[model samples]
Target: QQQVKQSPQSLIVQKGGISIINCAYENTAFDYFPWYQQFPGKGPALLIAIRPDVSEKKEGRFTISFNKSAKQFSLHIMDSQPGDSATYFCAASKRTDYKLSFGAGTTVTVRA
Candidate 1:
């Protein structure tokens, strides 16, 4: 399945709050995991990524918690802010081919 269903589909968060998004997939053949962040009319940027080999991965203010057995993953935004407002997408691919299977999209709005 090339589709990645992400929910709430959209989100609203206050400044300094935590924002969470979840995703699931059916392709066990996929191994690479990458979470992308996008602003209006812009290409998605890689926020964080992990492999099924690892249970979790984190960056500065971004975190990706993955569960291989469940074929699911989630993104956690710590101390969210207005600047963090954007769309997020969780993707899976085989290797470093640069080809990505994307979620519909998730829009996050952070208010002050």
Candidate 2:
């Protein structure tokens, strides 16, 4: 069963603009939040992640903004490029369970 919900099934963004994807979950037991990026015919790769203890985490041009109380989180891609075009997935998992529940992916297309 899917425990995480994501919005904007697809997105088109101009180069150098910001691309954002949001996700929400109902499970309070979730402690690990991860975002994965995948290209055509390729498996998803872990892009970034956050824990309930932190409100936000950033690496390079990617950022994950988390809301613990609201059970929501978001991914922000700054200066989006054509190479960034891919399907992104938001997932949640509990530390003890070690099983992830993923949201429907959002395909992002960056326009040059």
Q: Which candidate has the highest TM-score of all?
A: 2
Give the clashing residue pairs of candidate 1, or none: none
lDDT scores in order: 0.90, 0.96
Angstrom error at residue 66, model 2: 0.5
Give me the candidate number with maximum lDDT: 2
Instruction: Please give, for residues 15-105, the per-residue lDDT of candidate 2 as tens digits.
Output: 9999999999999989999999999999999999899998999999999999888899999999999999999999999988858899999
Off by over 4 Å in 2: none
Residue lDDT tens for model 1, 20-111: 99999888888998998999989889888899998988898999999888899999999998999999999888895667898888899999
Off by over 4 Å in 1: 96-98
